[model samples]
Target chain A: MTQVHYDKIALIGIGLIGSSLARMIRKAGLAGSITIASRSGHTLAAAKALDLGDHYTTDNAEAVRDADLVIVSVPVGASGQVAEDIAAALKPGSTVTDVGSTKASVIRQMQPHMPSHVQFIPGHPIAGTEQSGPEAGFAELFAGRWCILTPLPDADPDAVARLTRFWEACGSRVDQMDPEHHDMVLAIVSHLPHIIAYNIVGTADDLEMVTESEVIKYSASGFRDFTRLAASDPTMWRDVCLHNKDAILEMLARFSEDLASLQRMIRWGDGDKLFELFTRTRHVRRSIIEAGQDVAVPNFGRNVQAPTDSAKPD
Target chain B: MTQVHYDKIALIGIGLIGSSLARMIRKAGLAGSITIASRSGHTLAAAKALDLGDHYTTDNAEAVRDADLVIVSVPVGASGQVAEDIAAALKPGSTVTDVGSTKASVIRQMQPHMPSHVQFIPGHPIAGTEQSGPEAGFAELFAGRWCILTPLPDADPDAVARLTRFWEACGSRVDQMDPEHHDMVLAIVSHLPHIIAYNIVGTADDLEMVTESEVIKYSASGFRDFTRLAASDPTMWRDVCLHNKDAILEMLARFSEDLASLQRMIRWGDGDKLFELFTRTRHVRRSIIEAGQDVAVPNFGRNVQAPTDSAKPD
Candidate 1:
């Protein structure tokens, strides 16, 4: 039988990450009993319908009571409220962690409400699809992905080690880092990319010269890529923007500065400069593929299916 | 028999689009004989090895001799040179076309050099993967994709119809539009997206605070999407930037303006504004999927594989 890392586990926020963890934990037999909680009764019911956990509750505190490990998977902006709600109910010696995108902001929001007796660790899993909700998750969501944990300076070593084992059991490789460094790294890698995608999609939508229908029809050329990122959950991204403001802004500024130079190259017909930059960027994708962070196949392997002669018009 | 569209089809430039067309035409029996030409002997040899055509040559003019149709699929900057080279040898009444990303620039470059006896149509097939070269092509590359044709004002209707039929047989739906309008539409849908992607990837590469390894390791979070577009063929993209400068500059201005507003919203903590924009962009992705322009699955159907418990860490 698979080893149980936690006797009772509490999941706050039955959204994509939370529900995915529940499914993985159940499939791996990492927990004896699971309690799922969400502020929305609709979401909680969805989790129940999926048979994701042994218990479901609308009350965060009620769900966390007597739980040996608690995972708060709400948006970064909601971390403080969830932390406050479950602080009093957390079992002594229990481990409390989160799956937020921004580390520093989550730490700032949830650290104060964490009880002294419990071990508090802030984590961000670098894995997800653009989909959300409990129904959108699966057991393999975390497999081959990295889960980063940002523990407090004085946190208990045994508790951190136990949480690491729990994530590894769920099919993630864990890395520990400083909360500030995590935010900085993610701003350039995640936050800025999402913001740029949203901005580009919005720009295309608002163009009077080019109709929206044209954008959608010819999107496979390049614009379709941004749409995937832009389609990500708005509420979650809004919170990420609000909570990770500084790092996101810094990265945005850098991106704009670089864009201006690229614009100049285009205006001046500097093909050499454009080629140089374009060539350099290609190496990054190769390295990413080599690192096993992305599929090496072209078009993300979306074109693997054989094309029929009678295929419908795009 | 499928009814051949042309007795002899000459392909000038044996890169991604050129080679894909050769494969498709041969597969569908759309052409009785194929003549492939490339400026570089290396590329000509590659096409010969693939058996992509019935006849292969490094001389563009020789390839076009006695051909019923001539399709030039080189970078936009080289369109004029190819047109000049093949003009003397193009059979009278033969149809001529190109598959460049920009229509107006290609028209401006090739129209003057084209013989009055032959139809000169500027075309852009809104299809491709990041990978390029003669080897990175398949018969299905244009299946279910839109191919826009920008025929000249005085062009023969019979020639245009014949070209449309040819593309249809190769698995593309054809649309006709003004060259200027095509450039404007493509600037927003294709050119701007590539520029923005390249710029962002360059920005991430330049960041001192975030190491390159971190960016690559955590890229699946979002940055990897841009890398695909950014990793596209540099020479082709550079020529696109130079050829479609005016329209691209206009789109870039608008995108930068929108991004500035988005930055201010992030800086001022205007969550409602961010949410509004984010929500609006999601519908665009849905429309693109519904229109058959992109895959409807999350992450472009990249995560469909079952997550094995023994999977290597990403």
Candidate 2:
């Protein structure tokens, strides 16, 4: 199982996730050859400049021809078009999967176009930074992260096992879950936080009394943390909003309702209610740290930049 | 200017900020003697064990006796009580200030009780981590942080200058603002973020559809960023909400209104609006980095904890 290798691996998008996968495949020598393709010529040029794959092309079909594995890393909205583009070119018995955040939507978008001989397995690797594009990825992006697969009931077990070994070799732990459950889980953990972050940042920007300079100058207190997630890839997040509408909307509604109650508690001076909620939230952070999902560092241990003149003694 | 010194310094709360002040005074030899006091005996004992001050006391009045500088670092809700407790013992011509997050409330609670002979200037040092208590502080905690002072119009210029020198010795740049304006600025930059974090964490915890374990497992995607702020001391946050009520409520209302609009955009599938908002927020994060307020580390450069078995392959 450790010796599993793909004769050729075709990556359908050369953004952060796709480029990271290409780097990991090369680092582990898991693919005999790697082909990279992207819709943007500039991104394809960057991937080539980075020497990320054995073959690079703008044509999705050309990239997947004769490939044993095809991984679509585009926004979920683009998954259908890419699936249609590459379906005819996928070699017999090749396994097709994705690294989109929403698994159920990806399956729905891609499964119809897939050939009978090809296996389509939808997956999401629960890892990323706020950055995007080919230059933002690294070989270690998946190290110690989770790669969750939501395989169709009829997906060939042999193909699934082969892909599992591939992710494991890239230093990710693999798990299986139903696509619907994965969507719900991600909505709470991933989608809602980004939406909230974006909303709050937009609100801050629109405040007439509070100058943007003041917000930027004093952001270290707490606001800066939200800015990181709010600054995530807009195109990707927009696709996520469209593709996983039900779960995302459900989580958003719940989040807004909770916020209204909290606002009321504040308006009424209910210190006890506020304290109770704040105390309980600390446990979630502790559990995540214990679960090895995050490190227990103050401000994630970012090396703070030296104080500017304004923050220094005159 | 570097030769400025206090004959005696009293720290009237041995939590993270107060203990950090004690350490800085000791490290810089800025005070001939230091007294540390806390209502909680355990915290006072922790300060004593750490040798953070030359003296330790449970009596707030006793700690303030003959002190040339008295810095109250208690929760905002307790500022008035502490002022009342320490008023009689405050030495003539001594300076009394606070390190509370809310300036107007601190000034309101503390100013009336201060004798005319002693200068009562409200201050807030905008530096801290999620951790609390004496053991969580370090001498370097304020090395590159901002300390805002909201002095009364009648406050003596000499007294304000002396306290400014003290904060400089602690390695903080000091800025002066009106107490009300300070409260408003902090409401947008600090209090609202913490409130949002606590609210979301609470919502995720109370979810029936998603389990806490799943939230913890996938938190690295985005939820964990909020958790750090949510993990901050509950009592402190509770007091912040209660003391800075008007400003916090105003910010919360604005945040909620903006969120509702964002929710509508998502519901109506306005992908362009979503992308535009997300793209705009990125500029805030970039400005913060360029302003030397935060580093540009991706995901704050958290060292991935070595994967536990579940995140590792068999």
Candidate 3:
């Protein structure tokens, strides 16, 4: 009883998102055959153990051969290499996409490598937890999250619509925007938050005056929230920073400027400004909750496994 | 059925933490009566609606008339006023404690106003969410969290132990630290995180280029986490920053230094440094979960209405 959305669906780079997609595709019977490829032999073996796909390989080209759909889920740094490695074997009329955090750079890296026959659509699913690796994936990961497609001006609408429908079935709201806008938007919401978390945690770590136990004990107050974000997979985040330098830097500069003003408020005991800013930020969280983007509590993993229709436990 | 650890417990400033104490005290039969006092008529009305206390008053002095145990849970900025307001009415042998975020200032502000007849103990419970107000409080807010007490050098041992036991009955693990050190520790964990979140959200708001839709739509990536912290009560956090200035500034400096180093890593493409810091931060989350400071999904409000002897809910 497979839905069979594609003749063959290929996944390049079987990490958290990739593995989850593979599993969802299988669960939904969305493909006749699935080929999984990653540069690491160990991950491929793990995929085999889990039987995440019908075929597994280390060679990107071997994985994509004759496939009707190809999804590249790798570090932004590796997008160019993966695009180059798999270009020759990508079948004519196949729809290709990459779930990279930074869309502009991915398009820049992968577009030139496209063999003209494949419809290359650069996309990002605004979904993930701090955890990574094949073992951390679940079928419901994409459900209720957003899938952002950054299609080239010349890209065919039918191909985009088909990909959008595929993500919808996997449980995602789809939106398309210019790649540059996507990059800048991600810089503020995703990249800036991460950089700040990493910075604060690293700062606390190096303090000679405050003992480690103190920070850990008091972390739940607010610092612990940053720690969860700071704990996100580093390799992927570093690539995001490297690949989206201009946007990230722009966002950082703005953030530092805002922080300096806040620091001034504290230094001068300007309670009104601090209070107003704090109160206004509350509305943003309300909007997100209203939009159903976040769980009520901080630990999303538990929310995912809870007996809620929103999170379907296997 | 009142276990009545104390004949009367008075709560000054019945907001999130205070109301929570009222709930837990009633449920556990730990106090013969819970008396809630707040400056705002609106807040007092809300607390009354929640059935959090047996008696309510607008005058702090009137509320503390015969209290055996009095907890002042006001903004750190308002600590001096609350202390001065209630100082004259405190019972001769009563234990007067606080649930303020900062201790040094709380003691400095309140000690001078307090009578020699009462035992003055400064304390804080490191438990909260972005939500505030009386209605937002849950009896389980302090479950498995920490309550830090900074007793004076000459404070009575019996008073300290009894107060510690009271918080313990509320489901908190109690610890002692120097007031100055406590401020320093909280600066890095709670204050800095909230400050950073506020700054980043403000920065996003100031952006003329990226539309609001982009920020909300893409927040799931990382920024959404910061919004939760940013949404915290303004008066509470603003007072925390002003009251804990010296420590907050020190932590801020360290944070900036680490951020500069991270910026250098990104600018130079030094992936390994970023990777190490990122991976190391992940362990802290694990530790927090293990310590039960955080749920596995990390933010489930505890099942407080259930009997304490029952095992944690599945």
Best by DockQ: 1
**What are the models' TM-scores?**
0.98, 0.96, 0.93
lDDT of 3 by residue, A131-242 (tens): 7888877777777778999999999888888888788777778999999988888888899889888888878877888877777877788777787777788889878988
lDDT score for residue B229 of model 1: 93
Runs in model 2 lying further than 4 Å from the true structure = A303-314, B303-314
Highest lDDT against the true fold, candidate:
1
Runs of candidate 3 exceeding 4 Å displacement: A1-4, A297-314, B1-4, B298-314
Ranked by DockQ, top first: 1, 2, 3
Instruction: Report chain A TM-scores, every model.
Output: 0.97, 0.96, 0.93
Query: Scoring model 3 with DockQ, what do you get?
Result: 0.38
Order the candidate numbers by TM-score, best to worst. Answer: 1, 2, 3
The candidates' DockQ values read 0.64, 0.57, 0.38
Instruction: Evaluate fnat for each of the predicted models and list the values in order.
Output: 0.77, 0.68, 0.54
Candidate 1's residue-wise lDDT over B1-314, tens digit each? 23336899999998999999999888888788999999899999999999999999889999999999999999999999998899899899898999999988888888989988888877888899999999998889998899999988898887888788788877888999999999999999999999999999999999888889889889989999999999999999999999999999999999999999999999999999999999999999999999988888888887776776643221
- Considering only N, C-alpha and C atoms within 3 Å, which residue pairs clash in candidate 2? none
Native contacts recovered by model 2: 0.68
lDDT of 1 at A241: 96
